[model samples]
Target: MPQKATAKFIVIEGLEGAGKSSAIALVRDFIEKHTGKAPVCTREPGGTPLAEKIRDLVKVADASDPLCDESECLLLYAARAQLVARVIKPALAEGSWVLGDRHNLSSLAYQGGGRGLMPLVSAVSAATLGDFKPDLTLYLDIEPSLGLTRAANRGELDRIEQQELAFFERTRATYLSLAQQDDSIAVIDASQSMAEVHKDILAVLQTKDW
Candidate 1:
């Protein structure tokens, strides 16, 4: 009998300015420090070249074109498909932990709940062949107002961030709902200081013994 191979795929998810990028970097550092191997760090909407182009269109494009929510949802999945095929799948098969800034859950929250593209979510999930599901997802929880403020301070708003406050409220609520429903997802309170948030994430990873 052969010993089973273990590969952990962790994702950091939250609304805009939830510090997902920083959290992912921290997790990568933690993994390297402990395991002597640097996990593969990447992000959705822009991992591979093609996907990145799509991401730019989705985020930076002017709003004059009148893009439908369903179309937006499909584009997300399209980018995801390319990313999985080109980057994530390969990294995971090589026994590297693939840390993603945002994964499928983001689509479920932003597109499905926030944009009211419920049917598109299921359609895209099925279309992607279900090849991507995070082994563990860390949802950085924060109040919408706080998150929005942080985002505004950062710089110009992207297409998604430009959405109304109510939109983000729905997005945040959806994230919380997912965390409650999924045992694999751990919600970390992100409203605390950066040091505290980092400590909370480290604690979660340690408890998981990953």
Candidate 2:
């Protein structure tokens, strides 16, 4: 009998409006083509009902009471912890591949870089996830201005998305830096057309051994 496939977790990461949703679809198809198994998909700040509620809490803002940076950072991690434990780990343990729209990298980019909270974010991550990481991370790289422009066209911006341009600039810079240091992470030029970006992503999946 063939050995059971070792489930691999693939993460799609980027700044707001980086085309992550479409990328996830492409990756899902690619995984099914390669593995002959449909990968289970999930999104960060959500997956479970409880986690979704946490997602809402982090995403929506009150007019008079804005969430502090520390509170926002911690809230994001709290939602992530729930999703990882309740969904991701279990799916992987069952020999099912998992595709995450965003993972811990989002926290690193937004909370650590955007909010300048890397120290506290690191502590929270270590405590919550230890060294757990995605097997493959595809970061759709785009200029902050372009990303925000795309997001604006989509509709109302969420609390996080409504942040100033500098916030996303910091986030993008950190993504670039982190991708440079990580073998598992691949950067795609999301400024290109969807066809071009999809082509690039497929090339990475096909060519990279990982």
Candidate 3:
């Protein structure tokens, strides 16, 4: 019988300024170096061409007509639907590792928790995209205040970034709660020095043989 090939799907998740993008880049580089195979690095709300358009609409829309909580949740899953259909599923089918900057957990945190929408968003997302769970999820944990400070230093805030500190605190709590519920999820102290955080992340990936 032919061996069943397995492809790892890893997601780096966190709030704004939690350094998820940087972590994804580092993981992709490490995977390429070790396996000589470049992991497909992408982000939610914008991985595929269609999804990218949705991302812009979600991120740049004015706050006056604030996206309703349910609408926001639906938009996120809509982007994920496109991304999975166009990018993620195909990549995994081809035996390429998929490393996402954010995944479904992001919707759970940002939309369900931060926005105080229905808790069923997570379930809806999972049902919408069956068998799409990440093999490993690295949650960069940090205090909301610290994250906001870091984000402010970076530049102008985006729509989500402009949310109040309380919102982020709720998001963080949601992430932690999810991590506690799922064994595949790992929490990293994102407040540490960049080098140290990178090292910790690398160690986790190495242990998983990613």
Please tell me which predicted candidate would have the highest TM-score against the true structure. Answer: 2
Determine which window of 10 residues in candidate 2 has minimal summed lDDT: 1-10
TM-score of model 2 relative to the true fold?
A: 0.96
Q: Rank the candidates by lDDT, best first.
A: 2, 1, 3
In model 1, which regions exceed 4 Å deviation?
1-5
Q: Which scores higher on TM-score, 1 or 3?
A: 1
Per-prediction TM-score to the true structure, in the order listed: 0.94, 0.96, 0.93
Q: Which ten residues in a row have the lowest lDDT in candidate 3?
A: 1-10
Once fitted onto the true fold, the runs of candidate 2 whose alpha carbons sit more than 4 angstroms away are 1-4
Model 3 C-alpha lDDT per residue in residues 1-210, reported as the tens digit of each score: 122368778899987788887898898887677666888888888988889988987888665787766777888898998888889889999988888989988988888888877457867876788766899999999999999999999999888788889999999998999899999999999999999899999888778743
- lDDT of candidate 3 at residue 87, scale 0 to 100: 90
Best of the two (1, 3) by lDDT: 1
Q: Candidate 1, which ten residues in sequence have the lowest lDDT sum?
A: 1-10
Candidate 3 total steric clashes: 0
Candidate 1 lDDT by residue in tens digits, 1-210: 121267688899998888987898899887777666788887888899899999988887565786678778888999999988888889889877788989899998999889877787977787794655888999999999999899999999988888898988888888888789999999999999999999999999888855
TM-score of 3: 0.93
Per-model tally of clashing residue pairs: 0, 0, 0
